[model samples]
Target: MNFTLHQLQVFLKVSETKSITKAAEELFLTQPAVSIQLKNFQDQFDIPLTEVVGRQLYVTDFGQEIAFAAQAIIDQVNAINYKLAAYKGQLSGRLKIASVSTGKYVIPFFLSGFLRGNPQIELKLDVTNKAQVVRSLVDNEIDFALVSILPDKVPVHAVPLMENRLVLVAGRDFQPPLGVSGIEIFQYITLIYRESGSGTRLAMEGFLNDHKVPIKKMLVLTSNEAVKQAVMAGLGCSIMPVIGIKNELKQGDLKVIEVKGLPICTYWNLIYLKSKRLSPVAEAFLSYLDREKNTVIEQNFQ
Candidate 1:
């Protein structure tokens, strides 16, 4: 209750960047100054906000909870300023949005079109994996989130934006077994998988679990591009979003497996805190998403 906005801002930046040094550089402050500010803020509460693991600083669970509240406070304050400025006939403000890695392929296209019509608005986009996206949303660091999988317990409102079908893709040179049904294709090749905490990974795991596919020898990677490259190199096969492999498919660099009862299509949702009041810029962006959701999905997917 007694924290200053500057302290909250510093905390948010550090949490987002995961480094006090990097956060200080971004905020144009010295590292020691940033550390002092963070220490001062942490002293107000009984529990420590950050924990050091080896050389890295990580936000503790308690810290994360406080950070979430801090973000809401910051957002509300900005919303008030935006409202006052809007009454004075200024419709200019920055909107920050975080999205899952796959969303990078789709959100920018929609954002470009939206920006064309509203030149006064500025956008700050953070492209990361699903876990980071959820964390940012929960912390109020992002105004909205676009992700493939929704968390079980979210303090936010989420709306289904589009349904994505996962596809099994392989290099052009890799040959799938002949005279086999789609469900049987899994027996022919080693599976390449995404790292833990990935939405795509979670969806694929759920699908395999439902189908009872044994996955003891699958190779795991941290990036979609890396998975694609590995597939192209004939390292292994992977299940990926069709959107991520559109160009590869078009170029014949990869081929989608024709599998029946596979892929387990999932919905990508747009998420925002349920109780937080949105600023005009954030509200306009949300409206744009609602209006153009179908069009964007069709244009990108089909």
Candidate 2:
């Protein structure tokens, strides 16, 4: 079987995106042209690479194996080009990354510094919840992830950046129960929660479970911004990462509820796959993060 470099590149993009249309858009090719290339690749190998499941496309195990090999080849080719370009003293490339919601607020500061220093580097950022961030990292869909929760069996190298303190917040209109403990405060007020599989939600649940707080009436919402909006609207109170609500708290739009034995703190980590090689741009960004980690956190959270 014979395939061109363009075919390999297209296949890798499609595998990463899991959507033909999206891949086509990214590659600047029409849907039919992308489909024809994929069909030719499949026919040459006499194997099905992707299957449509519901409205989404999924790469088969065999397809993933091929895609992985293709990605390695592509990375090597790009590395060669980068080295060649380095001989002329130029650093330029695209960097793709994923991050949890809270990191959306802090990571940009470091990235901005890096971008200012290297204007030639293009950065693509995908900000989602913790679960999606982890998923994207594991699937090799993203180069690195900035997240608050570290999975038990992470197949990646993670560097703890800072502790993400979860604070119980409420609208300024709401009052904390007087002389009551953290556990008791839950009994007096309705709780607004982050959606399932969210790191914030998991941390809050673990804390509640540890304290033996029964959760009966709870409102689940997605995204930290949404949670802050709900709390500001006086819908209910929530426990979220301090970085997410720092502005609200400072502006008096929201207030931090002081509860005994509360403020669940977890570490935020800069995670990347152990086996995958980092591109020069990615390495430079990581170095910038390592250097400015403390300063960024202090300025953002304090």
TM-score per prediction, in order, is 0.71, 0.71
Model 1 residue 31 CA deviation (Å) reads: 19
1-302 in candidate 2: lDDT tens per residue?
79888899999999999989999999899999999999888888767899998888999999999999999998888777767667778777778889887788767876777788876676779888888888898888888898787876878888887778888888989976677756678887779998887888999989898888876568988878888899999988889888777778789999887776678989878889998899888888888887877787677555
TM-score of model number 2 = 0.71
Query: Which regions in candidate 2 have their CA more than 4 angstroms from the true location?
Result: 1-87, 176-181, 298-301
Give the Cα lDDT of each candidate. 0.85, 0.84
Tens digits of per-residue lDDT, candidate 1, 1-302, equal: 48789999999999888999999998899999999999989999899899999999999999899889888998788778766767778675778889888888767877877788776676888888898888898888888888888787887788787777789888999876678657777777889999898998998888888888766458999989999999999998989998788899999999988776666688777788897789888888788988987887778666
Model 2 score (lDDT): 0.84
What clash pairs does model 1 have?
none
Q: Could you give me the TM-score of model 1 versus the true structure?
A: 0.71
